[model samples]
Target: MPEDPGLPAGWQADSVDGDAPAEVERLTELLRAHERAARGWASGSEEDVLVEVHGLETRENVVVRDDTGTIRAWGSVHDRAEGRMLYVHIVDRTLADDVATRCSDVLFAWAEAQARQVGAERGLEVQQIDTGAFADDERQHAWLERAGFTCVRTWWQMSRSVEPEEVELVAYPEAWSRDGVEFRLVRREAGGLPDEADLRAVHEVLEGAFTDHFNSAEETFQEFIHRLREDPGHRWDHWWLALVDGEPAGALVGTVSESSQGPDGSYVSYLGVLDTARGRGVAKGLLHTIIADAAARGRDRVGLEVDADSPTGADGLYTAMGWGTKYVTESWHREVPVS
Candidate 1:
């Protein structure tokens, strides 16, 4: 057993500033290689790394380097919500088993420390550290399990190709009404920013919609807006709110996807319909709005992730809407008591 949880003997660990072009390139390459090994494709990019590590206020990152000054592993923790801390773990597959295991220990320890700090700051009794892995990646599964994390859920990463003609086929009126339900983009103010009231409505609708969902936690308005704005692809117009009989009932938040291997796309970052608005076509209407918006923007596809064991049977709806699962991912979580 290693005496130090942070690093093994002869290894050096340091906080990453998320600057230094060479360091960023190396990290991006490491991410790409890992993704390719796990899923047969690479989607990691320099921009993604920057976004993940740059927001030091709400995130912390560390890098493990060998004696040769080569980075062998990377870890990041995001204070995702009041009681949840999101973790990112990446290790070089080329390293020896013992070395890789030690790297995992270091990253896991760092994440646990960050989680506890967040919990203490929020005055919580416990904090959940949430991490994810490719479903088919046995290495990640072993690492997570060995670190006392449990596989909590599986998600289907689904995608649907967009046809240009869909812009004409799908009606995307600014404020359309059907069956007493209205769908429209969140209103903008005179300064070109989204209306505060509309934004709050979207947040409240999502919060209410996910109240009964698995692993749901309370996220403050400030945290919600700050985290979403951190994404490089975030756009004001991609946010849509649904009103059922003039009451906020649902919301859909979409983001642009910049792909290096193919044309850019659109991703449904979030879609939530309040329980009171279920079965009213609110969800379907929101989906159509984003699809039409993607088509108008010439995006090749629209992608979204659905919980495999969702009580709402959302996967079925996505499948029926022409979306197909392209890959699968699993969530792993470990809870630590705040000290």
Candidate 2:
């Protein structure tokens, strides 16, 4: 019998454990090459991508190598979405179209199939397959369309360089206090981990705050902490909680990431203030705290991302606070039925 057409020709597929340093380095180089031409990818070192695939658990990380044994692309579905969604990544534009198509199509199809399977396990009502492509990369857009994805939303990738300044420069403490808001880092134990009680408080605040945010979903506490810990720079000290009159009112979670152009600085992975606590400077207070802590640690920048069409006008808040857009990426999603 002839080889299966559903599988790419002259390509061998291997399911990786997603825990190898070699795999991370290979994918990072492949992505960096694509970045040069597309500028659509979020950039970071091998450690960044390494920690990602090797996250809590990945359904699979597929490597596509030509007959010559050259890596043309890398793809993966980090199966952490609790079956509601499958988040995938494929390093496009790094290989010739014929070869890339043969490899990538198979990888993408595998991801979709895996999403359905996982969703079934979780008893989900609908399954979503999520991925991204640069707005300008028609090649990727074309591939996405051919594979059944539709462009839904555009995202702004923004960053800002940080400089040393007095806490007065952030200057929000007094204003926040007047509104009965207080900011403090999550308490740490002698062993250097965040206090369990304080950590749980931060999670509760975020759960309530993003109830109306985009594509919001409930995540188990195990999933939340493990996902963030996968980053190489995650630390207990970087987490903070805001109090309104000594009651937990909000939370901010920041971490450092690898940056090639400058020193690695803090990235706001999550920030939320309860609905009832809005308009009282809790968000501002958290930003000020992050900035002050970054300065204290001698880091050179503080970066964050916001939904461009956010109803809350979050992009405006970040712009006024000194961050600016670096580039853009878009979310392309397609729904699949759980089987």
Best by TM-score: 1
lDDT of 2 by residue, 1-339 (tens): 124534455766665545666666777887776666677455656776676566546445666666666566677666565644545556556466776676667767777777777778788866888787665777778878888889888888778776777345454422234467777778878887778899889888998899898767787777778777777878777888889878999899998865677776888989999988888888888888888777777788888878877899888888998889888788888888875
Off by over 4 Å in 2: 1-9, 17-21, 40-42, 56-59, 92-94, 170-178
**What is candidate 2's TM-score against the reference?**
0.90
Per-residue CA lDDT of model 1 for 1-339, tens digit only, reads 235654566787777757788889889988998899899899888988998879888988988988777888999889998888999999998988888888888888888888888999999999999999999999999999998999999999999999988876446635577888988999999999999999999899989999989899899999899999989889998999999888999999999999877789999999999988899999998888888888888888999999999989998899999999999999999999998
- Top model by lDDT, which number? 1
